[model samples]
Target: MSAEQTQASGVVGVLESVGRKSLGLFEEIGRFFFILHATVYWTFRRPFDGKEWLRQMVRVGVDSLPVVGLTSMFTGMVLALQTYRGFERFHAEGFVASVVSLSLTRELAPVLASLMIAGRVGSSLAAELGTMRVTEQIDALYAMATEPIQYLVVPRVGATTVMLPPLVAIANGLGIFGGYAISVALMGANPVTYWEKTFQYLDLNDVSSGLIKAAVFGLILSVTGCSKGFFTTGGAEGVGRATTSAVVMGSVVILVSDFFLTKILF
Candidate 1:
């Protein structure tokens, strides 16, 4: 073939491959979303499992507190320090509290906490459920007339949805405290004044918005994790793929949701 013809053919081949891959990705995403919706809908149907939901709440929420606290505290400190430098230059130093509190409560706290939870908890959930599926435990449940959707999946999803807001709120508090501590101890700022500004400028809407984002993030994490696990095949390799996908997709969704929420709310 002539050089020009060969180049054209190669370009066409690349385009075809890209198109196919994109289509496949969309298909997988659609299937996963469908399964997630079904699982959540089934969870709300019929009688509830109070005991199981409580267990999962403890597992997801209570156990996650320490890490969230540490992370948020540090975030708050860094935010304060960073904002101080810029604001001081602009003669807007007094607005530091407003900047720190608003940023954390509206954006950073929910997004960062959700991403952390996705990495730590979502991946674990996918791996655990994928293993159970591979090991025939899901089958055993089915044989015993226990709906896997209700027993195995629903509680986790419900618990995550319930737990994430609280976790985000905790993270926000810690992050603000971190900023406060740093300002007081290192920056020589008055603690009472800093806190007073924070509370004064920070309204219920700020915190409430973060909580709303947290709830959405919780849904994204749990649903994606469970979907990946439910459909996982090919044994260990499949489980690994599911775990990775769960984290990546959960993070992506969180970012996208953040963008939209910011636009709408702000």
Candidate 2:
């Protein structure tokens, strides 16, 4: 074959490969939505498992409180310290509380809380379900005439979705307190001024927005984690891979969706 023809063929091969990958990505997205739909549908169907749902709530929400609290606390403190430095240059150090409060309520609290949950809860769900898949427990459920989506995914996704708003609320309050501790107790900023400024710029909408974002993030992480776990293959290695993928994908989805959520909420 002529060299020109060979080069053209190579270019065509590259295009084909790109097209195939794009198609595969769309196919995966479609599958994810299908699973999400199935899980949601089965969640409200007859024979509801309130006990399992509560169990998942404790696992995903209650167990996640400590890590989320610590993360929000430290984050608020650091945010206050950093913003103070910048505001001090303009003789506006009093605005540090306002900045920290706004930042935490509008963005940091939800994003950080979600990321922590994704790391902790998402990985755990994926690993647990992956183990079940590898051990044939999922298939066993089918053998017993149980739908895995209804039995496993629905409770987890529903519980996480239900619990994340409250968690985010707690994180937001703690984050504000962290800022207050730094600004008033440590930095010697006026306590009344700090507290007053913190509330001055904040309203109900700001707090509600963060909670809304948290709920959405919870759904994303839970669905992604459960999906990864349900589809796991291979063996122990596959479980490990699913766990890692759950965390990575959950985090990515949270970060990406935050922009759009913010825009819409704003």
Task: For candidate 1, list the clashing residue pairs, or say none.
Answer: none
Error of 1 at 211 (Å): 0.5
Cα displacement (angstroms), candidate 1, residue 25, comes to 1.8
lDDT of 2: 0.92
**Candidate 1 per-residue lDDT over residues 1-266, each given as its tens digit:** 69999999999999999999999799778966786777867876776889999998998999988888788889999999998888879887677887888999999998998898898889988998899999998899889988888887899888998999999988988898888887778887878888888888888988998899899889888888888888788899999999999999889988997899888876
lDDT (10s digit) by residue, model 2, range 1-266: 69999999999999999999999778657757887999878978878999999999998889999999999999999999999888889999988998999999999999999999999989988999999999999999999999999999999999999899999899999999998998888889999888999999998999999899999999999998988888889999999999998999899989999999999999
RMSD of each: 1.8, 1.4
Clash tally, candidates in order: 0, 0
Off by over 4 Å in 1: 1-12
lDDT for predicted candidate 1 compared with the true structure? 0.87
lDDT of each candidate versus the true structure: 0.87, 0.92
lDDT of 1 at 128: 88
Worst 10 residues of 2 by lDDT: 24-33
Candidate 1: minimum summed lDDT over ten consecutive residues — where? 31-40
